[model samples]
Target: MDPAPARLAVAVKAQARALGFDACGITDASPPGSAPHFANWLAAGHHGEMAYLARNAARRVDPRKVLPGLRSVVCLAVSYPGDHDNPPPPPALRGVVARYARFTDYHDVLAARLRDLTAFLNGLGGAEARSLWYVDTGPVLERDLAQRAGLGFIGKHTNLLGRTLGNWCLLAEILTTVALAPDAPERNRCGTCARCLDACPTRAFVAPFVLDARRCISYLTIEHKGPIPLELRPALGTRIFGCDDCLAACPWNRFARAGRLMREHTRADLAAPDLIELLRLDAAAFKVRFAGTPMARAKRRGLLRNVGVALGNLGDPAALPALRQVAQDPDPLIGEHVRWAIERIEAP
Candidate 1:
């Protein structure tokens, strides 16, 4: 409520916009109302293999645990262009990557921008402005903070959505010692629209605003380490890296446009990649192709596993040769999925 800190907060938001952030707002580093629900979600095994979410549970509920003197949290959302950010369902065997992964790794891109923002905020707040920042990597509950900061409301699909920014955003945060006036939280405006829930190929949403990661295509393709569940394979379709059906299904995306930074980060090769080409990637080839992109997180075998599922769903038979070559892959996980694909494709 102090004038000096309020002025600094306004300056910080302006600097963030200047640095290409689509939205910015501030909230106190207090415990969020959703913390108990998050605990229940984790206790019910909804987080899947992302054990880190549970490991840092305390810090996530209380930002003070992450930064001992934390006072305010700066929440930011940067939207990527709709063209590559909202890729339509693939035709036949064409593989689809999530909108976020189609471009360079956002961690790298957003980190640099956040660093600059941090420096500017520190300068404005004087020596008392100690800060810490991260792009989706820390114990911070970013989406919850963003909602409290008024950047957007959490949609029924559990992704953040703004009137203008939609759900196509990469969230990042800065926890600072400076006491900035907080923005009122955005009210949930999703109403009864069930488009995101209906659009999910795997039906991962257990209920409104709740996601079961174990059944989520994005979690299976990108986070799960072992073979994907047999029943879920067919639903994966041709998404080899990550899934975006829910995010793309949101009507708010109609307002999304290609900003200069987003356009520069988009990679043409990642848009509608041929399944055959991706299935052919060896460990070496996979690294080279996805080096700077978000897809690299899947590693060679993880990606190959998803590709096998796509091939099976493709049922094109043309992918048989590719599947056969990896049938005996040294990695048992990849080999298992490849054999499943062969069986599915060979099924009468």
Candidate 2:
């Protein structure tokens, strides 16, 4: 690599920081060799109903297929740290949403910043600027690319753990035709740390550096579209959107700080939503409430379904009315979950 290219890479990093990314790094766009592991994971039915993972297996392993002539992957991390854990539910509330869903959807926020970065890179040296940006909407092995870019290591929980920002940050990638100098992969910093592994209520981690998505609370609530596995519901606790137990348990988060650009994105109403209110939400109401938030991805039916599970976990008789009301929901999945909740709440 020419020194000029290296210098340009350094300048790009600075520009990325100025553009509001918490951290940035460049890596050569290459197929990550995690396909065997992914294949095994899928074969074991660990991905549950997230069939998309299996559908794009080849494209996900290689960024080049998604964007031909991809020479570099500019990975960015944006912190969305909260001042506190999920908020306490109201006296009669039964569900609690995870903190990440509390604010504006990170996909929009981070994609905008990535567009700016790509524009900046294009202006430099008059490159054609052919590039694609992804905020979890593309077939890309983002965490692996982040690690290759020296941005972070894939922690035991399988999240990209930035040395400075921990796992509370969102990842976005810009695959470009520009051939910026690449950074060496970072060393794993999770030495002797098993807190994340031990904190998993579902024992999702089959072993170090591996996660069985089927048993992960985040996957169960947010990714799985059908009825949640009976055995995993009890381990979900009150997490209705996603789970952060493993991320929170990581020791490196002690040094993590909320990114200045995303300070306003901290936990808001969704820190812990009232389960009763969530269950009562119709499609229109759910859309209005979660218009700009990540929770909207779950859609009205999906979210209400999770709320039913949370209500079941609460096992409070006071939640009977809310559960029964949703039991007649138009969506079969929501109604099924509501019935499940009714059984759990009425038991004993």
Best by TM-score: 1
Instruction: Encode model 1's per-residue lDDT on 1-348: one tens digit a residue.
Output: 458768878888999989999899999978888999899999999999999999999989888999988889999988887654445755767888887788889898888999999998888767767999999888988888999999889999998988888777889999999888888899998888999999999989999989999999999999999989999998998888888889888988887665567668878788788887887888888889889888889898898889888888888888898789889999998899889989988999
Candidate 2's displacement at residue 147, Å, is 0.7
Tell me each candidate's TM-score.
0.96, 0.94
| Colliding pairs, model 2 | none
Query: Which candidate wins on lDDT?
Result: 1
What 10-residue stretch in candidate 2 is worst by lDDT? 82-91
**Backbone clash tally (model 1):** 0
* Per-residue lDDT of candidate 2, residues 271-321 (tens digit): 767888888888789899888888988888878878888888888888898
Residue 82 lDDT in candidate 2:
50
Model 1 TM-score (2 dp): 0.96
- Cα lDDT of all candidates, in order? 0.87, 0.83
